[model samples]
Target: MNHGTEFSRRDFIKISSLFLAGSAALSTLPSGIVSGLGSNPMNGKGEKIVYSFCEHCFWRCGVAVHVSDGRVTKITGSEYHPLSNGKLCPRGTGGTGLLYDPDRLAHPLIRERKGGKQYYRKATWDEAITAVAGGLYKIHEQHGPSAIAMLHHGFGVSFFKKMFSEIGVNKIAKPSYDLCCGPARQATVLTYGYPSDTPEGFDIMNSKYMLFFGTHFGENMHNTAVQEISEGIRRGAKIVVFDPRFSTLAGKAEHWLPIKPATDIAMMQALMNVLISENLYDKEFVEQHTVGFAELWEEVKEMTPEKAATITDISADSIRTVAREFAFHAPAAFVHTGRRTNWYGDAMQRIRAIQILNALVGNFKMPGGVVAFEKYPLPQPPPAHEHPAYEKEVHSKYPFFPKDEPSNTIASHEIVQQAITGEVKALFIYGVNLPETMTLGRQTALEALQKVDFSVAVDVLPAEVTGYVDVVLPECTYLERYDDLDNGRAFRTPFVALRQPAVAPMFESKPGNEIARMITDKWGIHGVFAPTVEAGLDKKLKLAGSSLEEIKKRGVLVMPATDLYRKPGEPLNLNTPSGKVELASAQLKAGGFDAVPKYTKHPEAPAGYYRMLTGRKPMLTFGRTANNRFLGDLATAQENEVWVNTTVASKHQLSHGEYVHLKNQAGIVSEFPIKVKVTQRIRTDAVYMVHGFGHNAKELKWAYKRGASHNQLISKTDIDPAMGAVGFQNNFVTFVKEI
Candidate 1:
């Protein structure tokens, strides 16, 4: 097995330091590549262990950060954590790489004008906080608190949210829910009385049939879900996937319907119709636990398998057979209500249909069906400071906002649109890169930020987003600082996870709690902010029936499990109007929307162009991970590639592995040429590419212009009527042979 080479333990240790994780380094690189790897090692002195949780991805696996002297040397998943099960994903393993990235925002920076051009100058904590607070207070004093908008992404979001909420700056936005999971949340909450707080993980291991509609389960490896699915598949759960691209999950499935893009709704409708017509539904369960079934039946009776086949490009017989199989499995089968929902604007309706299907199968609270998880009670923040709250507006031309969950996440595009008109004066960006994640195009985002009178960004990394802001506040990486307590990483079992410092704050970077304290102190905000990060964590620890000492010792505190899954006699405690599953939502009827799912036509890609679809990879978390050296090295699309159908290549006189310049429908051309992956894996009508690549930030040397930036081409979007999520799928593109 040795390729004529051997290394001693000392040599391995010396070489391993080059890679982020020495434990994983041997597996990643091949033989003969090791030539003095660990050049600049972490200044580990006397080895000390610190308990922490990863902020790498949203999964937040509990970690054991080993330190020597005052520097973090290693990060390993806490063996005690049930979520990660002692294994770190690619992103989590590369936590140190992000911490050590050269392009990181090491200190506070204030934007200044030099020769009529905006430039950033380094500032101390006092200088940065005072200036930022001054700008915010000015905006508040001149206009209103509502004129100052706060936009955030990632962990410690609640701190920012509480500040804005208490301060009457009601224009706060958490783009994760608003942009990513809003549609799914709206549909699920409407149907079953609550959203899937477990995110996308269902009780798949309890299932005999697991169905997916354009959902990539294994591909986007949310650690716990990966284990759950692997166990489910092992137990003979029949996996069925429907996607335009033959994804990794699709490959593992017993059946993968290479579905026509934007036609999943039709197939879902057919499945429902077939289940009802064949009397495959659990009639007793429906009668006892559901409302408005008759109305649902009325809508879907005409949507037969034959009709669905015509719309979805799936055969009628196959659709009927799949439906029959799905229903026959009954309460043991689950139709996965996914996270990133459909792009057809009718995403809410489609998700409703999925939830309704699961309901019809009588699976709520069941072992293998839609199981609700538990959450521990934590200390609530002190009552939000009272304020003169102006009537929060929808703030967008594209309507279809959920009546209930309105005004929380003002759309990114809408913010930009308003900023362009000078309606928004002050914008605070926190931990998010708008140029990468937001829709309406990169230039548009830049312009919008430029138009704002004052803007600020807080992050560990310098980014294209930071370039547009008036100030940049460098926040320490997850490894270097403490934050508020994190809970419910494993939703089924209630647990409290803590983030503790593995090392002293490298450079002048500070944690979020410190940043909040300084800003509030400068602004003279009293009785509104936590005195220290430990105070907040202590409050949470006290509430969770655990102590800071226990957390420091074990990294996580897992609560004992209860008989949570629905047993025979339990009632389905639905929060809908009738306290039953709303087969036909009365709430929807109240809002003048559809009560039951309806087939809606999606616009086809015009003549020569293909609908450009963006999907996540296990190694990347949006564009945030693109700059990580370890991840970049392992990244398949570090120099991003488009997944075009083999036919697309021949038709356009293109070749596999050749470079192509893609010009999206809005006349936005790719910043760099991307490699063409001409394969039969994707549909001819559409092209696919992994997101978070093609980053244009000049400071991110490893990531810059390496791949095609999907956000750059994401110039068009369809807003979901119910959830107000920007549909990134309505975008189309045509490739140019010559740049």
Candidate 2:
């Protein structure tokens, strides 16, 4: 694929400076490139173009879809979009694969018993909408709206959220929170006074030094982040990575220290000790812009490098050397607060340690350091007539669980537990395949699904979740649908991008807006949505001082780059209770949690088992691309392989390319055999597997039984008491060789 223009070190520095300086205007595509491609039926080559954003992963990079004879031909990166920068990841370019998948749900279905066996029967849109609306309304009337909940993923969920909100059902949750972004988000809020955003609030392109703790950047393949990291490498930035496995990002690091798993907090404390004891940290910055240093030092004073070396299995001298080097790059260095950070139950404090490290180096808002980017300041149109006040949201037990996140009030695992307990009677599963998702595990997800009184699944594919739901609404793919305005992402150049259709909805599938509208209409609710999805989009755009017509041409409307660097001696006015960076969080302390990060040992693997760590392929997102044949065409993308360390493989008498069924600590065996990859890249104590595979859904022809299910092996999970994030790394698995 055409990844985009390769930048020289000088070119990268020049572009990065100009891009972040708030002076340079964003460049647009040449007018002729897409001239006469939209409205004209025949553009000489009988092709047309549509500007939309990708749905393959949450990065949401803008895409230029080329259509020929009423079908999508190809997808490329939109040069105008800030996130993509005219470059596309492997998944971004594979939209056609998902759009045209044969396993896609062609029509709405309702579960019906046939000959004493339950199975799905085809239903019309009206029938499906009526069933969903009636069930939800009945549940709301009988148990109040608190018993109705929605667990969703993807951009298409906005409309469904509106539908549920109108009836006062606010128990909405995204599995991404409990599983992926929650710990980092809440930790940053406590430490930096703002939640972290994608591209992760860093100036990667200009950084002179970068530190990562188990953050697999290159492997994660977030478009803008990867591009900036490449630029940073070209600019001769030094990198340090601390991970059990030698990940793709580690390969580029100046130092890749394979630290012991679950001992990251101890390593971080040791680094803090070095920075303080060696007088390498910036005292001026710390004094001027932070609070609670005394409390922080008190906690880390005894966590010397030698003591940490014993705990973390890294040499004391090496930890000191890394600390000094990190300090030497002051103001331009940052320890990356990683994504999917809920590794141990102490993830919140772990990230707090990382935040403190960044603060000690005085990197907050500095050039090439930790900087919060702004979102496009697009004004919202007034809500479509206010309804009665929503029920006082039922709060989760976790003290620091975020109540402000509109999309989620409770953790997903809580929702599952509530479902199984019969507290939540109705469920709306949008785009998320629960059995394959890491909420608790396959058994728990299935139990919840079976126990729920009514469950409706809105999805494009007939995923495993759909088979268990009472009703299935076939929502069209991103290529054929329009989601709400996507200005949620914060970036260097603030922008609002559009998700216009590239082709009409295929088969009996409808876009989410239409499905949501139909259901609300069945409930006798009106005016919640505009006359049409496009009309509502146009109205919202006009409110933002732009129109749909104008934005459709470029797919996005961008604001000038915000000035990211701090001026000399500028007073820091953060939003935290202290109005400054909190080295030791008073909020956490008040809540009876640790004021400063503390290290605690986690459970060790049993004699014949290893900790089962999970991640994703750069080309595949969990569940989303599991059945994308075009992406799966690559040998590496076909299935997930269990990466066993060379020594461990020998000990288990397993050879490379052999197949084995993973048996977890709970004695739950993988249904399918996974290929064994004997490599020295990973540590012996832990085995790694890419998540989002092992599809059992026969409807997913391309993905069925492709690999072992990582989620299924996770019989145990550690829940963060403060933030409610779920950590599944505690699960250990041993290999059972396939006959």
Candidate 3:
């Protein structure tokens, strides 16, 4: 264990010889070694192959796990997969280490008393189930089922929804909407009349021109998108990137327009003006497939490149050039829908504007451009049962729910505040880490936990949010669980895969679906939860017309081949009210937002302060994978690095790798180590940092003090007026030297 001890020459020779012998042995092993020990470097001996989906970030790429005697040896992308094409990102490969992590919760834990800081000894499954059910019954008896809120996170989500519905708790929330992808989905639905879940696939490989506005498909590793985009560029497609920082995608782009932060809407509007003024838009396609063009024309007529230059700080001439190129490119041009649109106020409107621009060029639903299609295949199941008694007890406050937001729409910050105010009596959180994900301060969520009567968190590791829970239940990683891959919508192919347990669950951990089933049985709501899961699975299988057991055995399934693009006169059903891609959305007007896509001035950063913009790092997947030793070791410091522009660094007299305190408008400051990325590629008025850092949890020993949290420097001052999405980028912060 002593790392510093020097080795003798003889000892060094012995070590080198052993290593060479091991390498030689590995070379002689079979390609698919079934054992842990083998000559092949890629394969191990006695390895049990299991199919599963990656949960590192939500691409849900199919993976194969190599398990040996109940231990997962390695994880690789399913070579037989039709979507990922046998490719796995670094985060997916590192997921194996998470299963055997020392910090993983081994058993259920409960607080000794209400509002207590310390937890009692680990309890048995029966005890944990009984306690949770008893607490819910108590809260129901006193207040009502409405007092109990179920906050679900991550995959296997439909299972939780069934449990909450059966248990008669009508209050439910998910972190996805307000914190991440909500704005994009909501905007797409409002404008087009259909949810963005069935996103229009971008034919990057076939396109001649691609425009990216803050959408980094390469770094985010959206399997199909990344592969296609890269191929398209190699085949001579021109890529233009518009962002405040030189993102990984921007670096590979043909042109990088490093505009000021939050100025994307202005740039897009300017492009629209150019297309209209020059008469370069697709006239035939627009007249046939769109409505409200006159209204859109009237609104955009005044917003010329010259007018937009004042707000966006881009040269008018450059905007005109890009616009003409994109419009004239016709069938070979596309505007990609970027992830993480829930970062600023009016983000929904911003996305609508971008999508409208794509439609103006007649790029919608065409090959070599943006095309609309259906992708996911459903799995098979059993039968349905009833829970009439429980159904009657459901809260009426959420009757409008699953109607407007079929998905959970409650914001994380608002849920925490309600818990603190005693509006919520009980909460069960699964998979997500609210302390790190929520825009509100960590202390605010912790205080909310203190006020709640009961809280249960099921996770792989004892995250910071676990400290605030009444019960902490350990859940198995993807490598040791059974999951269906049919849930994801394929952009490039029609395929379905199965995620079988590669190894038995480590310790007492269980799959999230199984856990939900157990809780359902305990609450005597078997009729509801049992039938729902069975019926849902059955519906999926019938859709595929395949046997569930056979699909499980094969580990992968593919639906009958269908046209990837929809044909004309196919009874196209647009989710928008007008039943077409709306150039001007009526829903926005009803919601008090601009009906026509219009650009607004970006919020100005205060003097002496920089607009602190946060995004993902290539190495890290939010805050979840930071605890993995293999991935953590790849970076020198296992935390976030604040990237300061050389201009700003010089102004502050700060050097690279120095510690600094990032102070926000609300006076909340986070002290973190900084790294100066001195490049003219980033805007001088902005500072950049990767999100999912700044761990305050004492239990995360490796991540505790590694980096500063960008979330800490973001105030809860701005929210998207239309959809209540958090304005994370609206924040302005000043960096002070840390003494």
Candidate 4:
């Protein structure tokens, strides 16, 4: 159960910085640590196993790691944990390749530019940490802490969030909710007291019917949800999906509506209209739990199924049939709150429309409907400050989403725009691959990075972001680190799970806590963080009358099960101001936003242009797997083809498998010319591609120039009125045959 260290050729070793060495057991180690590191074999020809969590994606499935002689040999789903349930996806199984990626940052590197060329040189840990502290402090003095903005990604976000808050930096950019899930959360919270969408909230397993839009759950492959879907299907739950492509989930669904892109709102409005006019809504539940029933009906009376048919191109009869079927199932049916919902400017209204349908059916807290995710009072380290670190956020256009406040996030477009103007002078990017993920183009990202006086990137592999930074600090991969205790806030369970290092930190890399401490110490503020991640877990465990030593032996501690669903006739309280389910939000109306969901037309692609869109690959999550050799051999990597409609291809005399060049409105051509898959699966006016390909960093040997970057094709974005999230589908592109 003990972990060790794998030192690099720097001829330096320091276990004191890594707070994991705190214990009476470490007293048994050799007094001379550096002499031991050069030839140390902690495993000593014996087998070792450890329990940890997957770091491939945010799902964070519980995993078991088997280390043979200090090298990770295998990783599999833990049978005892709820998320994994003894099943692992392609991403989780391929984690070992990421841990041993040859492209990994071997040492601290300083971005050195001489004459006309830019290059990197190896730097010692001392030199790099001092540069970071000095550079950041310099910016703080000249422009105040707000001049430094950050984009926190991966599980290490909590560390940066706390550090930035302590430094009094007002702009610690959070992108996930605001840019990825903002609309869904805001719409859900505005309707109910809390968010209607959580990883554990919806009882998809017990449902009789389910509906989806945009999100492809089967293709995304969250182990727990995939397992739950299997259970639901076995019980005869009818599934329906609406997407531009015939995704894996669409193939499995009883009905797949190949609606036009960015038109999910129109279809949903038509469905709601039918339910209201036909008297299919739950009259009893509406009277008991909500307000503004009549006004809601009045607002949507004209949005008939036929009118929606013209907008979404889904037949009026098909729309009416699905609406009736959904309503017929009553409280046993669900409208799935989808992920990756920030596709259009009207995203919040669309999500609100979907959630409103659920409330109208009286399905909010039922066993077969959407339920609340329970949180357990676990042990933890005390806060750095007595009260909250940040003040109440100022009002925005759609000031409703507060799962993690949207106002706190620097908008995808806003961050770069501000950075280009020298308003944001320094940036400390943690785990975020901004060049690939965010829109407004790869050029925009580089320009923003260049505009900053100081920029530091912390990562394992040499990503596109690394080429844009002034300094790069190599961080230990999750396999060789201890992170915050895995509290099941996102899952259906109330438990505490540990993420222990199965293998020693490779090379000169350090874990998140150690990195945080080093920077904070040099930055002259060290009291903000607990001494170690384990210490924080111990404090949390002690509050619950448990100890870290007790959980360490077992690996996880699941609490007694409690009902997450509301029972019949149960009185409940809400986080909303009025403490009631708001069918019409007073807060929204007060803020001059539409209280009821409304459908507005989105901008169409130019006459000769095709709209650009993106989706996830089950084998890869957000294309961060580009550097993983195992994933590169997983079939899709070789074919990394752009999906063009057969009808559109014919007009341009293009054929399948031919390399096609895409030119966006901004005149930026894709970095890689992609093989075209001319098929009927996608819409005629739009082309699709799996995101996370076309990484241009030559250091990333496996992923460079492999496929195409969706980010490269998108030069402009529309911000969501609700949360300042980027509308990812706003860009348009035209084709050029790469003959």
Candidate 5:
């Protein structure tokens, strides 16, 4: 176990510091490598390059890890990968920070009751795996397979998912579903008959006009999306942004309408009304390729720009101008269906309005507009083993929740509630830090964690959730492990990316594949996974006329770009119920929901409380990078500050750069104090703060108590009835002068 530290912790920090300084230490590395130093590496003796994909965020950009003397020195974007296209984001190049983090979960841990209190004791891999498997099996035997569920976030969880399928346990949920991508995905499915893919099915680079509801493209830092948006900007694309705060993307907009919070539906309806009333819509296309035009018109006709102006606080003239300009752009114009659209409770309908606007403009499948990208056509190998049919698959109570995604069966918040009610007995928390995750709230998440009969956490960091779990399995970082091949993402050029190890896993940490294999073996189930992770990957690749060895050279096997544009006179063979765009979804109406998007007024903030808004900083992706000190080195990334409107701050007698705590409507105070950012970038009615801070886990030394906990202040949640996506923007907060 003593792999005598060839690179001391101090040495690693020094190297990182040098990299950060843009010094000659990493000058020989490839462009987009460590610290954004773009240089071609001249590989000399004892140097090698390993091609792999990054796990910093879900974009999964391919990276070329440079190894010198058996240490990962730097990472650069792989030219062969479609997502990165030889450009890397800041977070992608900071993988070394995560791998070398001193606070990383170094060994498996088992909770022990000592002195009438619980604490974690380091255990061997065998002991930990056995305990976890035994406990979960006992729960399955006593309560049935339906009692077990998994809440996962990263690609590494695929191995554990396969292991659970062996025991007929299929209830899986991802917190990102309820929090980020669920609304956009489900709304697209209802309107277009197919789910929206990543990049949200937009042809950003070719677009002449882009309308964003509340999407913060520049700040979110989704690699490919940002790259394309930059290209669009260079090509003279006009942008329109409607948001309560003047976000990073808003600053680049041709028009930044400070639309009132919770009144987006009313504004969207007005846009639709303008297109219809002024005869600005694509009449021929709508008549030929869409249904429910009459229903849509009727719904929006009464919601005039003047009426919407009153509700949204944007001028009627501006709304009319944006609508006309949008129509002027024709098929090259499109309304973006924003990510994390789970704001308020009517997210499904809110996004439905965006889809309708795009449809009216006849932009579907058009260049410079909306187009559905294709995924790589990699052939799947035969199942490793067949299992018995599940007694009953857990289902979401929400009617329109996606049933096609094989991984998730219900909402993550539903799983939390189930655990609280004793319906779910066992849980596997994989790569998600539940306490900071805005599912229901930190208190509700803690309650669920405490109520679960048996819980196991597979993570790389000892996050707050780990302290409450029965077993903690140490997972190696992506740079030191292999996950399943990633062909899930759809893109312009379909490709399958690899996740090969750049270096051996440090300490006692093991890959998810190995951990899953051990658990299946303990259950007397063999061949659920291949003999080895490499063997399985090779087998699947071989079926697709490729090999693991071939993919390792480039980090990805790419397919030729598919035709994104539909030819004129082509039949609109859509997957919807009517085989056409549904301006008013019949599926929604049949489910007893609104057929057409409707404007519903949400609750107003109380007397002194302001609506609290949450978002992420560009350099961090919530919990994944919260403890990553390399990314945190920047002053801007160290902690989250509450951005209060200058007028509101003045009214409250609050000074800029002053620390203050926040108290929510339910009388819950923020765990830590946040610095005040008195700025004119936000509206007077609401305040904004970046999410994923105020870490309660003392083990996360770098992230602990860095800022206020946005999730902790979220005492109220609005769940969309149609899709079950959770919305936390309903929570309102007032400044607390004292901690």
Candidate 6:
């Protein structure tokens, strides 16, 4: 079967049976299964059981690692895991491949000389640590501590950020805020005074209506949301999807509105207009729980359904039908937050408009509706002793630093760019890959690295950003590390899970926390690393009012809470200046953005040009899983393909499965194997492709030279004025057949 094609129920069952049979066979084998049992050297059944979390992506699902004779035998999701529910995503299932990857950096390597292509031979941990610390100290003494910057990626990044601050480096950044979830978070903060966990828990099982605006939960593999969505469907929830493309989620939706791309806000405004004009909204909720209804009503009065129809390309009648359905559904309605919101200049506003729709339907904080509640509890450590040196230094450098700097630095992308231009230095990158994940003009980031006297990247894989680093530290994967699981913030069912090292570090790789301890020791700082991960668990236990040993033995912990809902006549205190869900934002006033969620015309493509959009496939995470042989083999190519509509393909005489060169407004062009998906399902003016292709790493033999980089075509745009996020979807490009 083609990898991209869907599997029927019968095929799915067959695949599941095969997987179960394999698991049963593996389980029945002796605990002493070793390398001699199979052709693969790493294939082994070891006696030691390592319980750890999968760090492949942020889902952080629990897994049991079977190690036989120091080799990982198999990886599977923990059936006992409450979050993952015994099913692992493709990335999680392929975790072992990463452990035994041939291309993995096994030891510390340093550049032979500045700007040199050749690297010196691998060195011992002691030698590497000494060189890295010494280099950073030397740079700090000469240029001040601000000469360095740090860009950390994945979870457990707090330890590194603390170390950098202790050493007096003020510059820090992560792609999380810029490339991924920044806009949604910013919008949440602006409206709620704090960032609400997105796709925020919906009582989907009981919901009667679910409206998705650009949310592709089914395909994104957010375990909880996907499970809930499926459950909701089983219960007969009306799922409506609004997007420009026929997304996987849209395929399942009862109504799929192929609106013009980047005009989601306009559609949302039109919905609001209909609800208000027809008096179909929750009047009681609006009158009692909200404060700015009058102001919002005045602002949206001009935006009639007919006016919005012209801007959004949806008929006014259709808008009224959906609006009436949502309002009539009452407490069982929700809107979901999807990934990749850093698309258009008004992305945050677009989300805000969608969120406002939920408020109009009286769904905010209600069961079977859009809800907000505290996460499950976990054992937390006692607060660390203050390192006055670090405290005083950080305050002096970053005067506006929030009390919780790591959690508060949502705008770090802009800060990192400023730091690169010598505005701030002293960078420490813990686990993120900035060069590949950030927006266009990566050369500027590279230049920023060059300008900084000290740069450090600690990652399991030696990524593109690591090549430009002054120090490249080998960090162990989650399988070899001890970390705490805090599900108390996102899930209503409070729980604490422990990640026990399934095996000892295979090479000289150290856990990030251990590395952090070394840095603190070198600087004469103390107490950051507990005697054991169990001791750290004791702290979280105190927070949860539970015993540490009990949590460890149970492997999982849950705190059940009552289903809470918003009280009657309570104010809908959305944190916007108006206190109501703002149809028009007062916050965007200074930024020169339209206060109303109005649709602006997308950049007109010259005669032959088309707008391009990017999406994800189930087999990959942004650039991370392309190296897995088992998963990679499931897809013929990892490159971004131009999914042209049938009309456009015929007009251009483009054939399916042909090679093409796609060029953008900035003159950057990428060549790729094109697969023209001709269907009325897509809009004629646009084309869709998958991201994380266009691998440039020669070291990744299988992935290199396969796909085209979406970044190449994204440079000719500006940041969203309201949120400072890169407008990745605003580019216009032309596709040419590769002769």
* Candidate 6, 615-648: lDDT as tens digits: 7777677656766554676653345567888898
Candidate 1 — what's its lDDT?
Answer: 0.74
- As for model 4, its CA RMSD to the true structure in angstroms is 7.5
Best candidate according to TM-score: 5
Where does candidate 2 have its weakest 10-residue lDDT segment?
Answer: 7-16
Count of backbone clashes, every candidate in sequence: 5, 0, 25, 4, 1, 29
TM-score of 5: 0.94
Ranking according to lDDT, highest score first: 5, 2, 4, 1, 3, 6
How good is model 1 by TM-score? 0.92
lDDT of 2 by residue, 1-739 (tens): 0011110000100011111101110111112212211222344566888999999998899999988777676788999999998899988887777777766777777766545455566778888898889888988998988888899999999999888878878888999988788898899999989999876899999999999999999788899999999999999999999999999999999999999899999999999999998989999999999999999899999999999999999999999989999999878999998888898778888899999999999999998899999999888877775656454333437988886888788889989999888788888999999998988999889888877778888898877887677788888899998999999879899999999998888778899999989988999988899999999999989988899999999999999999998999998799899999999999999999898999999999999999898898987998888888668887889999999999999999999998999999999999999999999999989999999999888777789999999988988988899988889899999989753
Off by over 4 Å in 4: 1-45, 196-200, 385-398, 401-409
Residue 221 local lDDT, model 3: 67
Q: Which stretches of candidate 3 lie over 4 Å from their true place?
A: 1-45, 113-117, 198-200, 377-406, 488-490, 527-543, 566-573
Which pairs, if any, clash in model 5? 31-38
TM-score each candidate.
Answer: 0.92, 0.94, 0.88, 0.91, 0.94, 0.87
What is the lDDT for 369 in model 5?
88
Cα lDDT of model 5 by residue, 1-739, tens digit: 1111210110101011111112332333333434432333556858889999999988899899988766777788888898999988888887876877767777788766544445567788899988988989888898899889999999998888889988888889999988788888999999998898776799999999999988988888999999999999999999999999999999999999999999998998999999999999999899999999999989899999999999999999999999999999979999998788898979988988999999999998998988999998888876767767453233335888888886677889989999888798788999989878989999888878877778888998878888777788988899999999999879889999999998898777899999999999999998788778899999999989999999999989999999999999888889999999999899989988899989999999999999998888888999999887668887889999999998889888899999999999999999899999999999999999999999988777789899999999987889999988999898999998975
Per-residue CA lDDT of candidate 1, range 1-739, in tens?
Answer: 1101110000100101121223343332222222211322444457777878888777788787766655455567788876777877777777766766666666677755545344566677898888888888777888788678877777766666666665678776656655567677778878877766654637876688999987787667778887888888898888888888899899998888888888877788788888899999989899999999899888888889889888877889889888888888878888987767747668888888889999898888777788777765566555637665665577333244544542354765567667667788788888878877755567667767767777778887767787667667878788877876776433776777778887777667788877776777777786666566777677668775777877888777877764557767678777878899999998888777888888888888889999888788877887568877767677373666899998988889889888989998878898888899989998889999877778766666668788788888887777776556677788899899896
Error of 1 at 455 (Å): 0.2
After superposing candidate 2 on the true structure, give the runs of residues whose Cα lies further than 4 Å from its correct spot.
1-44, 388-396
Q: Residue 569 deviation, candidate 6, in Å?
A: 4.9
Report every candidate's CA lDDT.
0.74, 0.85, 0.68, 0.74, 0.86, 0.65
What is the lDDT for 583 in model 3? 88
Backbone clashes (count) for model 6: 29
Worst 10 residues of 5 by lDDT: 7-16
Q: Give the TM-score of candidate 3.
A: 0.88
Q: Which is the winner by TM-score between candidate 3 and candidate 5?
A: 5
